[model samples]
Target: MNSISYFLQPDSILFNSQDIDFKMPFGATACGEEITFNILTEVSINCLDVRLILKNGKESEFKLYKKKEKKIRDRDYIVWSLHFKTPSLPKTLFYHFKFLIGNSNSIFYYGNNSLGLGGVGSIYENHPIDYQITLFYKNNPSPKWFKESIAYQIFPDRFCNANRDGKLNATKENSFIYGRWNDKPMYIKNSKGEIVRWDFFGGNLKGITQNIGYLKDLNVGTLYLNPIFEATSNHRYDTTNYHNIDPILGTLKDFKEMVRECKQRGICTILDGVFNHTGKDSIYFKDASRSTKSPFYSWYRFKEYPYDYDSWWGIKDLPCVNELEPSFFKYIVEGENSVVNHWMKTGIKGWRLDVADELPSFFIENFRYKCKKIDSDAIIIGEVWEDASNKISYGQRREYFNGKQLDSVMNYPLRTYLLNFYNGSIDSETLLKYMNSLRENYPAENYFSNYNLLSSHDVKRIKTSVKDIVKCFNIDTQLQGAAVTRVLKSLSLIQFTLPGVPVIYYGDEVGLEGGKDPDNRRTYPWGSEDSNLLKWYQKITSLRYNSKILKKGEVKFFSPHPDVFGYIRYLPNTNDFIGVISNRSPYKSKFFKLNLKELVGQFSNNITTDIYLWNESLIVPIDSSTDFPIKIPPLKTLLFSSKSV
Candidate 1:
């Protein structure tokens, strides 16, 4: 018996009437557009039929037409194409291509992963390939300004102190203000396992306004502040009031002034929207808890009145709201004085939906619509931990990138993958695969607009992760301070160069280090700061602002070894190209040979002799050739731009 072999070019596959000459747009599409699938194969066959296997165990056969014989890369192949109208409404369509080969009753399957480079397998030998395409109604697009800007995430309670006199206007009941600005956060719990007291460090809106110069100097275009709405807790995920700033943080006047100052500095503000839940102490929730006849009763779900009710992650202090409840929905999203509209009118540029997965798609859609209605340029981002594309929440698929819901999401997948690579838990191959999958899965616009964060209020600081490399590798020794700083610099370079808005989490630029949650939310060290780390951040951010290619260019990866990762950012119609190469290995420095032709194609020959080394701050001239080799120090990253001769 002889084994059957199949050959399919994954690069030749196309969706939604797109062709090799034009790439398909990312994310969902309108119902009326014709959806198409194209496949190319080298196997000689007179009868080849393809079917689209959908989710829920159903299949739709595609009518094959217009077969053409062609040659690509010195190989002969047959191109097969199919088309169908997209289904009406917003729903994810999971599918894979199944090809009937000849009349022999044999089949070949191709999915997203199986259609890529080096993807070949028998239908019976491997699991069927699965691909997903989301179908949705078209709506207003995200503001262009957000898609083209770099963001800075500021945890408000910890960023700065404006008065220098160290005084909080007011503190929440049972909450205490820390006298020492440098004191570490306490995660202590009481006898009943409740956080009896909350702490504040006196960082306020006035403080942020005072440092507008620092932000402008750092080239930050947007500022994403952790919730400043009236809340008892320091983190402010539990919102006590939607209409007012927390007294401890600042007053409405201070907030308005801060926004004004930030705007003058060219920095837009995005507030965190905690619409899914509110603090139990909030007026709305308190009234509901006190009486079933309360106007806000429907806003919450109670198994038995006050004591037993639904809360976010079962934390009784943060009561989860019935998002779709009429009055609640109206107040938060639909009414004339809706929270979304009110905040937008306050000069803040956008809102980042907290725990977007828990919120229904209809809710998000309405919120987005209302947001745009108020300000056409107002951006809406979601706190999605997984791949926003094709993400399923609460057993239902979400339309996050469908152009009607979220404009962008936190790029956590990239963050984790990059950290793993830098921590030596994964090599360059794995890292590239993860990053490429995201680039391929998301819509191009969303990909560029993604909030690419290296550290945030939720995760451990990148510097801490770098210094704790031994824990990642399961070793006993700790990494030294200098080595950790070097590795963090390399990671920062990659973060700023990658497609998406590079988000500098508060004090990450100045080497803030801590573990998870409360610890990650430490006060930004003022006066005392790591000068080298600050300088590196300033230089790299300046580079991003200066280079258009770094912000909006298409990226391609090329590396010679497992320890080294290299990528190029280039625009199609321009000769401008930026090259980023990093050595993740901690033990030895190595010379990396980069094949310019393989990465940049025809433009490789146009590169000038001048090469800029970011780490060394030197510009050296080299031969303008197809291949160039440069030595990279261990745990260091190198960046250079290609200039036309």
Candidate 2:
């Protein structure tokens, strides 16, 4: 007798081979659907009839049934399919199937009797079942408020020229224009013979205030700016004075005016708060390093490393502060005028915490208490790269999702995973599996607060993933730089419509691409704009903000195939919304069928809506039952919402 073999990738796909036949389920093809397995082999002619059985994990409620039995010459082959519904599965569960076939007196044989079948070709040793759990929810949900509300992430200094007279500073380099102040710079030499510098772009509070109308025209409701506290260099991650805005960026008065104008237009302002470390040049550090006798010396730890002292990530420029110090905490969190309280009093709506993982859980918890004391509804988002629920940073556990510390977190894991899937480094099944795992660690409301982003100041732009310059798109050398507007627009659609608060990095809507570090932090291209991609973003934002199903509806994940992925969002109390399938393949109207109703009650033909047309607000009736199959276009996401669920 031939042996049966099976293999599978983790949460990917499963394959099985028995005698002359082979069977497998394509992970991408059978996304949110159920699959059945039935295997049978003949026992000697009527020696106590026995049935072939399959057992999943000890806790799994999975059941199996056999189908038509076949006989060929000396052997009988039993056939069956495995069927069960698991639209959602816990993150930590691992699944394996076992085959128990034979009666009490009947013996199971492998290659030899010396090696018992239990140890040799046993189900555990030979065949490991491939089972993946997924969470289903509506795709591209649009709850009012979010669609019409445009989001703007400002890099502070690089955003505008803060001069009151609008006159350029003669001393400023051709690449940049300095504003009112001479901010400190950390210069470095690049590949060119000349010295490269990390100098401030001189965009300040005054500049942002002047451009308030321009932002309003873009329909922006939220303004997320990088750190504004007194600090050194371009990106102000190292804080010098948390209580004051960097003079180079603007004066305290400038911030007040900007906040006042933004409020009149219903725009909410969120400031970046770097609580993790302090600049070496900061007053706190300066007093500490001066000597142990200094009053602020207790604010930092000064251990001798070689000859001098230590720093964060081994960089002398950034010194880690002692957050555990009670006085230091009082000074930073609740000084004569608390930093958080001062800003809130100035009309700031929220804060985006930098390196939140490095700060102790106690600090964040207390920080939240302080902020809320000022304004209970103030939003507090953390910069975490993983699931905020179980996010671990600085070799310590952070429990921010228990409705204590953070209102939301930057969803970096989702961003990286999506990028990998689109780049073909992974498939949709992997995405579904990881996303389900992430959900396990977070609170339900955290979904709305999840700041999902693809490209930011920390990583390379998305366009670089598809093709190098001149490879994917036709470009005129005179225009210079790579042109992949089509790919960028498509990627933007997916980013904006995904299940979270889509965050737009400054200038990304205009199709700007840059490398890492300083390069990624280039000045916003206020001139040349990618009108096509910008329009695409506007359309998606408008739809997402207006539809409830896309905003707060339940997500129903359809089985994903290598070529396509589909999902539906149902508002049990309202109207249902559908995410017309989308894929990376450049093909239009590709058919993708998955039993989206595998979980039953979540989505069905009973809940119907009109299919939404692209670039328009009108909807046409769509019959999901009987003959309706979801079809998607390459590089596109379609959202449909009806008046009823």
Candidate 3:
């Protein structure tokens, strides 16, 4: 800790990529785009020279000239800078600053902090952990509508049922339908931990069709439905056939009707593309298992053939696909009526690829090409659970954002940090650091297009995850609901305001509570929703809808207290500064005077201001000074702006 003064501090304003003075063209750079890098260091180090250590494949070095000298807090400092253009292709480049100490002629380096949280880096003697610069293709731009849209994710089997007589749709022989719509989702497994009988609540595509108006009223412009392709399980991640809708859901015609209904109401559809694997019960797999010469035999890898085959994570129910196998590749990507082409022609807006990390880059690139060829506006969002820009999978750094593979990725990093902050696993300040690193790593297009979800079918519902993170059932029912509601409100505020398309899992708006897997996929309690929570969701959604600040404004993060996370969204051309602050402590209330002048610098003293609390919006006076005292109760968040918002 005592040696902190020697570091380059990549996360601070002195080296922050988000700041124009430090890194020109900011966040993600385009191919062949000129980028400027700057670093500030104390002039007392007796530094003789500073060089940039850049690495894409083989490492290279570039010289940095001393740009200026300045006095900060009466201490002398030096600003060193260099300019370089990206290569002809997109690549993720890493860089660090190495200095030659004058008198000693010894080499010292400065780079990213140990944990890579970005802010306030450390000085290194050798082998510095570098900062990332993602270069993306200039031509890959996602649809304008998608980047600006608000999304809703529906786990088909649990969202709704449109049967007039309450009869199940094409009931399968080995599946059971819940007699009641409110029953919690439960897996019917055998002693071997294998699902013996898939269960369903009979939610169909017709259900979504019937509810299109409801989704429209919720201010949802995009509907990201979980796997709708024919799969045996309720989750539908295991695909039996790519061309047909799961019978348990509905017929192909029903799917078309749903898409049509949604389009009529101005909603886009994104279907989950689960190409990494197929169901063991699928006829293709069954036939391949029975015969060595089956046409689909080479589509999968077999350890011994017959009954032994490679499965996804050793889950025998799902047979892993050999994505690069010629036959499989042709069928999925190059076929006349290929899987991607089939759906794209049907008017669906795009695909949300399942387990995107498992699929080969070539396969994804082909998928993207096919989709774009059919409908140029189609968006391709991959399910990459971490930082997508520089993610290393299978010992290879992924080029997802290089502009050929995916339009964007699932923003699991944001979800992870936000949940950790609210759950008390991490403080607000730490969360902000992680978030800043994310924003700095990704290109603006991908960041804005990323699907931001609080809850999804794969994880616990937001309500349950926040309050019952341990998965303990000991908490009283009423107490859990209130606690969940309190945390969710603050979380929703952050989710909607961040620079991405905020997705609401089907029942999350109404306070659905469940933990993991089958538990998390609980049926939406249509009649039992908490009205207040529903209204709260609506309020946040409407606020985001009406404000351009949330959609395109630049973000500046701050933490007035360790337990509170806040940010101001502002457009450079406007005087408006939209403020959002959250107090994540369970019992500790926050009281502090927020100095707008200190944060954003020199705002008009008498700026018309409105502070919006969860229950109400009130006028807050800011006279003669750019500071105002903000007192937030425990488990709450507030929005402030120059407008009555």
Candidate 4:
């Protein structure tokens, strides 16, 4: 298929007419390649020459040729050709065309008809053509693994019980299992009737290693296990030892084996890096608490009594580390093959930073640099929950795109906005507000690579959010279960199709619903999966991976209304792509104009089909209006591909 396909204005069923142009990729290199743009306009009137002006400071001459038989399907376009390099340097370039009738200097403006067709044609009668072109290279792998991957987050102990041979020491206080060495520690019961159960179920690294194939079946290419470093708690966020794997999680040999196995299977491992603080029972903290003679005493800040100890947010059980101390910094980041480099050497791909906002920016920058030096592809994902660009962590501002820190941070803003919109927390106004916020704060490349999630171990599942609202407001009878399902389904469609890498948190794909923290961290309901939702999720994943535009394309938002949201994703370099239209309401929206030309390429007629659902009869063609008026169903997300409808 031709790479650059362009269309002119004032045509009904723009795609059916012979009035269009097309181009093929040419002069290719690792950095980029040029596209041979073609002209398809049919005119009896005599025309002189047609040309394209690139967004960069370069221009290409389009040569008109006789009509030929280069039809992909029922439609055929006139051919014109040109060569363009991505960019010799930095800056964005727009691709548009101009036509000279008999060399009279009267230029016909063909604006950046490169993306989609709204507001893209010439705004002025005799203006030069334009298409916004941003320069991008092909070789830079993102440093944030979590953002680019389909991560399966597991709370190690609760995932599976691998060996039935393990037993718990019932006599021990607050500990649940014995000789269960691995990620599983112990679950304890409080003296009160309340079950203070943060206990282990004997699941170990061996257990996870055994189930690598199981995760792969769910399209999980990355595994984010809760902290496995030696620590006192079952969850192990508090580190007792930074260099050694928790004895319960397995010996370093076992961990090494697991990393090897995962790498072999194309699965990346991301361990939780908890550097914000340490447990009071930690080796350094224990010695520091014991006496002043202990050399580690200087590692922590302390006063006369236990109440005077430096803690993370005043939590005495977790004492904060002194990042200002050069020795501790060396121990964690700079030691020969230390924590970060050591794990990377073991083939573990990256670190999901815990409380990154609290860690010093300088430390994170240095940490990421060291990891890159060890392996350039080693990714570092920060746990900053807000707009990372506007976020200020640790009382000082942190800049991720400055090229020294995290590859990408968790997109909390996008997650919250999606959840709130689906759950009806606020309104479309709020959704649109955050959507604009995301576009402005994140760079285009990073936006595509940002970790887009609806629910995670840290928050309630999306189903639970809507369900809880129903139960709390006593609206159970008012809104039926089917109503809630429909709403969630529509939202899921949007989440899966939108920008950024969509991630399904463990059992979320199976419709597991629970609320916040421990509740949200329930055991994966192994065999009792919700078949309908699971199938729906599979369809979503399949669609995501199938569409190049959805994976990597320029996103353009057009006329965002209170009840309807319309946007287009264009991969100007590819022949296959689509326009995504969504209606956040439960009723079919009227008087809504969805502009398709705003996409990277121009379509003479707005008729397009759903690539995945081609034979499903869901395909719809564009009307004769300049902007297509879509009769989008309530709680529906519609996708339109450029091919047959």
Candidate 5:
């Protein structure tokens, strides 16, 4: 917006990075890789010179040569092009194109789209926006085990309790246990909105051990368990001690048994590592609380002898730790007996870091180096809610995906945009551009291993967020509400099929619904789960489990209508593929004729496939040449596979 239309026409110059013809090697690329940029100007513009402005450590400009003149839509246009290689150092490249147009000598700029979704961009006479190209290390590839796995996140205090006698394990002092297994979670807050006594639902490691078969049957290959260490809070994010499993959950032996059971069933475990802070009541903090001569004195920053100290986000109960402190750093990643290595010895496969943005880069670099030294197959995923490629934390640009740090990030952007698309807040074209923008920014290694999920422990359940009875778009049908349940099913279907490691939150698949923190972390409704939703999850997950193309195949996204978004996952050099077309408009249902002639080739004109009818299944032979009409129901999704069958 903020457009100044004075210097000439706005759409006179055209450039879009999302298209390969305009920008080669789309999105992010490895260091020293060659990149090409192209721009088109209408013949009447009389463009004199073109320059590519780049901002890395400083601002630099490079000239763009005239490639040719071409006719498009009955108009002659000038083509300007540039070829350049990224610098040797790993950094984010921010650039924009400028033009000297007309005899007036006014300079106009071509920048990212007005919305910053970054497909085709707009022309600006002033304050042009810069596009991002991430440059990363070339040789770093994520562990194969991670890329192919479908992960499940569990909140221990609320998942299950397997004891026959039904008694809590080593109950903590200041906590209350729910009387019934299905009781809603209610925090015991005081006048200051602080939880005075944490509540427990008696879900333990033994419960998880008992449900290993259930998880295996659900096709889960990875388990991302929330904080299991000894802590004052039920969430265990504030660590009392890293060595002990929270007694309320189980003993150290109990955790080992769970890991052993998971590994035997071909499931991997990733523990939550919270190194940014520790519980104020922890042994280290307590020792430093009294007297300035404690060995842990240097571990924390104290305003006055430890009575006043720096805490995470100014929370008094959690005292922040100086992560790179000599003794603390040594304790965390220094030796074989270190906290990270100590847990790795217990047979867990990876770590999901908490508040990763706050932890310094040197700390994470060493964290990865040491853990990979122990088991190179193990992975590290960080909790970063934004685009991690150019994330700036505490005034420092983080190099998380430079092939030196994290294998993947928590992909909170996917959750936001996916929900937005389903609610009809954003059209399908915007959705396509937003997703392509991410693919263009992140390297292929991290992109495939991204921790994708629709809902997590921190937010509302997907069902509660999207489940609604609404009127249809047809003028004849818009009079009353139509009670049809399709949003959750469609959302999960899309999540499973997208490029990344899809993660299912604890009770999302079973249709558990809630809002915000304590509410979102509800106990899994054991016997009363929605059968329809549960079976839907199983079918899609099973489809993913059995298909190689769904896991590692190449992807191309398309949006034939503003309300419809689609993608194709196919193995290279073959016509074998899977296609998904989702109509997210709450009111309108569009009959879509998908165009994949170029991708599927002319020979495979008649394709044999089975299209999922959500609650039912049927065999539907489709035309790959876009002639076949695919009926897409409102607030519903359609997935048809040729080879995945």
Candidate 6:
């Protein structure tokens, strides 16, 4: 008797298409849609069974039909295909292949892991390793323009200054102005050890309008301002008035001109919507606090008459609003004179909801409805910190990506993964797995439109984060500088190459460094800018703007070693392809061999190829017949583009 050997390769699995044998579309499908899945084997198999595992833990057998027998690279193989209709309703489904080899007593199972690739393992090993696909409501689509734009996040008070008067705005009653533009932000306290007041840098809307050409030079398509509305604080998360621009920042006329100038230069503006809470000094809250009979009184949840009220995270100054209150809802989104409608009437293109998880689904739905009613193309982004697709908040699952609530959420999970990978805490394989999980969880449209960022006003600057990691070990100063620069460049390379709308924090391109909150909000150093870093940013942004493959092409990842991560972004319909690889190890240079036979075969012999490292061109050959080995500096990145002329 001969023994039967069984094998399965999950990476070679294909779903819904016959031409591309390795393409697998996971997560979010429509009901009644005809879906096809295919699996390839090393040899001919007679006794193989595949099943669709439902969310209810029931395994339903799928009819596997042998599609064809073919020879690839001098190896014989068999292709198995399964076609089934997607089940009704919204639920997650997992599937795997079960093999029972010709009366053998043993059963071999193949399933997907964190990387979304195949491995021979148990069916019930550690909570369903099988491939997962989520079914969502059909006809849900995100905005078209948002998915292809390069987003630039500006902290309005620190981005730029057009007046150049070397003074700050002191119009607010209790506010203090800085004497010099390069002065460090002061967090001064009174004798009682309490923060008495805040200072301003006076970067206004006119400044932004004056610098529109700079953004255009960087090819920034979308400008995401932190908050420009009337507020006591510089950051403006606590809003005093939604309808008016902050006096210190600018007036309505200035804002209008800024928006008009940005529009003329092909840049859309995204305003930060702070609807979850209001400043204690705001008119609505002040009126309610003054008298119980006030019309705004019902807009708050008060345990007592005046002082006792529900605040956001126990912050007394920021009172949480009753979003479902008819009066409040009407004021914000429902009525003809609503804040959202009023702002959309301006030239602003979209809104990024502040603390969206705190806002109820109905409020978000109404907001989206009203915005779309006014302008169907207006995009609404949410500040969701986790996986927005299936995030559970307040004991309820959020439908942020189901096409009704948020067009996209900030991609913080990707930021964490990238930072950890570059900081030497995680390997390339782990990074790939986490990235693949995010890719599988999100809907395709939302995935592309995700606000991917490396640093923001809420977090420590990217340069500071990298420098801190290096300083923790007490390394040489020169080595530390080199390592930090390389790591930052490498991370930026990945940020620009990855799928999503890459967001550049205000001063990050100029190599700004700061810790948290007040520190991260440092004034942009105009005269002391790092020329090398700025030039590097210009080159990378140029590459992103010029390459269609980096913007919209499908991504395929390959990691030849644990320390090296690489991916190829290629458009199947077009002949454009981009290869990006990174070396995350700080102590050693790595020679990475990329398997580009299939990619190179797609191009003709006369194709142009160029390799670059931080704007410096490197010498590397473009060959189709053999695998290429490229040496990368420690903690550096190398980008190869077929379209680079």
Q: Which candidate ranks first by lDDT, i.e. highest? A: 5
Query: Highest TM-score: which candidate?
Result: 5
lDDT by residue (402-462, candidate 2, tens digit) is 4566767888887787666655666765555555545433445566667777777777666
Tens-digit lDDT track of model 4 for 34-97: 5444554334223456665554446655444545434444544333444545544433444566
RMSD of each: 3.7, 9.6, 3.0, 11.5, 2.8, 4.7
Candidate 3 deviant stretches above 4 angstroms: 1-14, 469-481, 601-624
Candidate 5 runs further than 4 Å off:
1-11, 468-484, 598-616, 623-626
> Model 1 TM-score?
0.91
Which run of 10 residues does model 1 get worst, by summed lDDT?
116-125
Estimate, for each residue in 184-252, the C-alpha lDDT of model 5 and write its tens digit: 898899999988998888889999999999898779999999999999888998899888888889998
Candidate 5, pairs of clashing residues: 27-440, 28-440
Model 1 residue pairs with clashes: 26-443
Q: Mind sharing the TM-score for model 2? A: 0.72
**Can you tell me which runs of candidate 1 are displaced by over 4 Å?**
1-37, 44-48, 54-58, 70-77, 83-91, 102-104, 114-127, 134-140, 470-479, 602-613
- TM-scores for every candidate against the unseen true structure: 0.91, 0.72, 0.94, 0.70, 0.94, 0.86
Better model by TM-score, 3 or 6?
Answer: 3
Q: Better model by lDDT, 1 or 6?
A: 1
The true-versus-predicted C-alpha distance at residue 461 of model 1, in Å, is: 1.0
lDDT of each: 0.77, 0.59, 0.82, 0.62, 0.84, 0.76
Over 137-236, each residue of candidate 1 has an lDDT whose tens digit, in order, gives 5654557678767788888889887876788867667777787999998865899888988888888888899988889878999999999988878888
lDDT of 3: 0.82
